[model samples]
Target: MKYSLQDLIDMEHFQQKLIAVISKSGLKRLTEIEHRKQIEKSENRYRSILKASLDGYWLTDTKGKLLEVNDAYCRMSGYSEKELLSMYISDFEIIETPELVAQHMKKVALKGSDRFESKHRRKDGTVFDVEVSLQFRPEEGGQCVCFLRDITDRKSLQDRLESLWSLAQMTEAGPKVLFNLVLEKTQELTGSRYSFFGFINDAEDQLEVNAWSKEAMNQCRVQDQPIHFPIAKAGLWSQAVLERKPLFWNDYNLDHSRKKGLPDGHVPIKNFLSVPILRNEKVIALAAVANKDSDYTSQDVSQVQAFVSNILLLIEKRIADEALQKSDERLKLALDSVSDAVWDWRVHTGEVYFSSRWYTMLGYEAYQLPQNFETWRSLLHPDDLPESEATVFRHLKYAEPFEIEYRMRTKENQWRWILARGKAVERNDQGKAVRMLGTHMDITERKQSEMAQYPCQHPSNWYFNKYQR
Candidate 1:
């Protein structure tokens, strides 16, 4: 149709506007469909992952009511999908308080994530340990998703690690301290209600109750009693100690032989384990665990064996340390008891070693003694210095016993008669003196007593006096 220029421009503008409107509408429809498909695909992928996970997964409302659960959750609880769908999380939780659950949920809601451990009951009423991580998301109406993993085995391992750590700490302490620690740790690790330790007294040849847990000691009245088990007796712990092996008894009441062999008024040994503390292939002590809730297994035996081995080492070290301490004490006593003072001389180094007792006897402290020979020479009386030095020189040159009577000044500046006797204990290859050990004695009394006797001028005078008497 023929039209005016203005009409043609309006028509062109309307057509272009219509085309733009149509294109915008088509684009919006395509975007909406793509977004919906993406959301669906993401949801499916999440569900698939959750279902395939080994750890159980659950979605709950803020009140902790279970809204959805994955296959793993159902499997862990031994419940059917339909059954779980109808049940709330609180139904299977061993926690009785709803307030605690609310508190846990509140933490998750506030922080967006939380983790905790709690006990969960199975369909058969058995309780198991579970570690749970709860994450809060705003998109799903603020629902919380929980990731749960069974941590029973992990807890057991942690307990074992703690026991081992305790044992290591105890090893550094003394024997009595270590024995007490062992008793406590054994009761804790084995979940035993009672435990005790007894050591064999070598001189008395009797078993003595060295340490016991409070519960065990109370029940057994072990404090006043002597723990005597005859080697010929077939007692559980006695036999284990003699054989140097671990012994385990499950249902001690059912074991008639053990029941008959047990001592009178003894605590009923139920689900017990015992191991020997061995040294030099002989049982020196016995450690026993009693009244365990679970049946003792091979693992228990192995663990007890390891613990007892460490105990044996600790005991042996303790004994050795005690012996060393006693020996040191005896040596000190011996040094103090002697009337003479001991001295050591290093010839090559020209160093003098004096005992504390020597210094004290001389009215001086150990620090007063100079490390060199000059100090002693300075203290010698002038008259005796030349004779003493001559005697020592002769002895060193001839490899003979060193003996000299010298006068030394005391702290009071009085000269006292001292008999110095020494021998070269160590010698060089050329037979020269390398070291000398000696004793110094206060011989003033003896010399004065000798001088008190009547003296004869000559042999004829002594014989003439005797003939007259």
Candidate 2:
């Protein structure tokens, strides 16, 4: 039953009802304060999770304007939280233009999410590659949430793989240019201001320059100098070569006795590193770098040594290739000097390489003859093949040098006496011939002259007797 307002006002207990109504109001206010406290506690938990994330993250409106940024995002951008929160998402990208970012966001909304690698510009004006995952939330008025992971280290590995491939391609460039490239790349890779590379000469006493980088030359401001840099003249460069290992001087001034000081116009070196290029325990070349920004450490020494060790195979191969080329030239000159022919047979492959002089001796071009045993069999006299084969088999079996006089059919179809001398230069574990090297010389005139002087009734018999195999 409801009491009328006049009835309540006239009752004596109306003041007690007023107190109860005020008490109910105070209880409702207390409940609301507890609810607000719970909400604040949950918000704090959410913020802590975001702040502790390893990946950088931020929230943006559909218009790409940044609404909220996490601590990670601030740290990643090299910016403070207040500064990043004031900027737009588009402002962080170094590669993506404003128009491009707009297009990306449009596509991302259609796909619900998108992930890609792009460069991000830091506040310090440096850039690094980042993997960005963008998510669009239709529930929040098309807001975009993004997570970023830095991939600069991953990119560096890819770059190193490319560098190895480039080094492989350097093989065809010849050892001289290849060495130059190696030195230049080493200086750049090691962050050195100057590079020095010297190769030991034939005398084995002098260190001559095989390659010098243009950058080192430019940095040192030298004119047609730093050439040779003899082993006796240079201090650390020579010392490294003598030690047959890598050496580093963190401070050249502290050890004045070891340092001869830089020559006029040479680069003023700071921390120094040097390594000897070894082949068969012999120091054949020297490589050094100097003038680093900071003091050299044991890690620097190890890094340089590892780098040199990595490319040692290529360096040795290049040196061998150069030596082989020079050897071929000298062999050619020697053969030409004596007007002799040369042939080498690789037994394993059953293939033969004939020198130009060998082909010219038979009045045939080098390319005209197929590089196989059949070429020799076909050009040799039928009677001479059996004897030559028997002689070769016996020599290979006995490990003896085969020196025999045989008749070879020339291009003109005339029989010419040739003195063939050959030996198995390389062998396998079983003592079987893997390779054979030899030379052939025309002895028809000498035999004929001996026969003429003997003046026997049978000219062939006289020639054989006078020549005496």
Candidate 3:
């Protein structure tokens, strides 16, 4: 216990060194703990971002077997994470086979990173376009990190726009060429394996196939396939024409009621869709496409109907242009063959040419009144004047199709329904129609039939009341 002053100083120094060492060790441990907390926080943020991203994210081995998938990927694929992990790339790769998928994986591994566009099939068996961004991370045991974005809508819009442009360019082409273009565009826009565009005969009993899909032509084995066929023989698919409505049959295979109309070796029909192109409630033409990879929906019907409308516009223009280039005698001859009555109006001179058939169709003699625009105008019923006049001027001014239905006064003082169709055959430098040629078909019987079907719905009944009054 009794010690010198120097001994006490030396003992105090030793105690101070021990305290310093302990303090340093504790500070170092605290710093290490803080670093670990920062790393964990960073990892949590990364995981949250990966989970919330709208684009699908997945990690797969070099062999194309999915190892991990995010919720977005699961939703995009219509499968759960566990289901996706159990599937390989070839299970849903539509554009490639298993061999092709393996080759693609090899290319990605060699390149380290790549971006490409491809199609993928969902669990529900519908296909969609995807943009894949992949990175081969050798550091992470050669696992591939991939991201996919759904581009189905974008790709559809782009294809539709391109189709429209192509159709517009082909408007001046003849009817055969134009119809083929339309059919091709329809198949592309709808993703159908086969398609056809056909015009209904005037009798509404036969369908004349004007254009057909190239795929159908290639796969079909029928010798000398019939270009025209009776509507009754078209089986259930003809309902679109007979019923004057659109038809969709998604499960064509399971429907035993579908008549056996396919010839031997015909391409098997998995699904079918037909949209009637209507004019004044009459099915003048129809477009049908078959065997899309998935079930056809109402959206497809709408798209086809819209496309048909554009096709009609182009067709009207083509007919007008062709008629204008023909001789008057030739044009008259052609009109006489197809129309019950014909009219030619000279816009600048206000003169009109009425065929003898026109007078007879109205129960009048030749030159009964005056062969002028006034004669046609006066015969139009009061209820139909505004729309009839607008349709005529619209075609003259805007080059729109001249097609209208109205009641016209016959010589017997009876109102007869007339389906009037025409075109502006000649236009001046100002783009105004200089001459218009049109045909008239008496459709009183058809109007009466429609009225009999639904008296309250048909406008013909309203016209009859006005005529009686």
Candidate 4:
């Protein structure tokens, strides 16, 4: 159609507008297609990631029935996909029953998400620890997505550390206490129902049963558990000690030539593990656990070996401490019988530990004065002090002989002759004496007799002159 110049311009404007609208719509369509592809890619990636995850991923209804399970979960639980789909969480859960599982599901629904630890039973009935993280989606037909990670090894390590810490704290509690703790911890860490700890006698022919786990004692029907038995008469359990190695019997019920039927009223054994505590390739002690829910593995053996080593150290330390204590007691008795007094001196600190006889010899109550060099100095007779100190200084500096007869003031204000003999017990890095141990004997009578026999040589004058030379 023909029109005026203004009408032509308007039609041209309208054409331009139409072209712009078409271009804008085409761009919008292209953008929508790209967005749809991106969404599909992301969904595929999410599905692939969920399927390939090493941790078990499963979807269940609020009631705890499995709706979908990943391959990883099927493998972890030792069940086929079809079998898992037909079962409920209660079927595989060891810690929580059907009712408890339902309660947990409700709690997760209320909280939207939850994380917890629980034990689960495998298809073969072996129980293991699992850590579960779950999210509930009410919009998705009240379903829950859950991820489970096996934590059996982590839990086992935690148990070992806790047991070790406990045992370390009880190292000084006595051998019986340590032995009982070892037995209890062995059972706890290995999931055993019974355990025992024992040592082989010095003769190497007898087993001295030291302790039994409380569970073992409760279940054992023996009228009286024997504490000592000849190794030759023992059953296969003693083989670990005899062979000087560890022994494991996953199927203890099976007949073996060495299986001397258990004693009457003994707790039935299904599986057994025995580990020897050896030093220099000789078995000194044995630790054993029995009746685990599952077969014992090398890990259990290692755990028991660590425990045995710790117990051996504690036992040896205890023996050394006991022997040292007895030696001290005997030494004290010997000194008392001879009426001598013991003294330990820390030269640098001027601290002195004087035995009770040291005070009693001076006619004073034990520890009546501060045990220090100043106290000894105050008690020394002034006339004998310079000679006595000179002799001590010579001995400390030159490692010369240290025997002297000095006069000390007693509680009764009487000067008594003291025969003092000592030797450096400890030295510094510079070879200087830092500690000295010595004995003191009241020698007033001997001195008096010597003076009476030799009137020209007075006891104090004789000692002073000899030390001076």
The candidate maximizing TM-score is 4
Writing each residue's lDDT as its tens digit, candidate 3 over 114-175 gives 99999999999898899999999886668899999999878877877777777777856887
The TM-score, computed over Cα atoms with residue i paired to residue i, of candidate 3 is 0.60
Residue-level lDDT of model 1, residues 343-445, one tens digit each, is 7889889898766666666678755777667877888877679979888878878866787877677786655668899888898899889898888888866
**What does candidate 4's lDDT look like per residue over 1-469, in tens digits?**
6799999999999999999999899999999999999999997898789889999988899889898888888888899999999989999998888998999999999999999999988998888889999999987679999999999889988888887787778757877777788887888778899999888877678888888888778888987678997888889988887788898999987887767998888889999999988877677888999999899999899999987788679878998998999998887667666678988899999999888899999989988889998888898888879989998989999989999988887786767889999999899999999999999998987877777688686746565344323
Instruction: Score candidate 2 by TM-score against the native.
Output: 0.61
lDDT of 2 by residue, 297-403 (tens): 55445545545555666867877888999998887677656678888898888898787788888878755788877788888767779989898888888976699
Ranking of all predicted structures according to lDDT, beginning with the best and ending with the worst: 4, 3, 2, 1
TM-score of each: 0.59, 0.61, 0.60, 0.76
**Candidate 3, which segments miss by more than 4 Å at Cα?**
1-16, 60-67, 86-114, 134-145, 202-206, 214-234, 242-245, 256-266, 328-469
Report the error of model 1 at residue 255, Å.
3.8
Higher lDDT: candidate 3 or 4? 4
Cα lDDT over the full model 4: 0.87
Query: Which lDDT values do the candidates have, in the order given?
Result: 0.75, 0.76, 0.86, 0.87
Candidate 1 stretches with Cα past 4 Å from truth are 1-48, 51-56, 66-97, 116-131, 139-141, 149-174, 200-209, 220-226, 235-244, 256-270, 277-284, 297-299, 339-355, 365-469
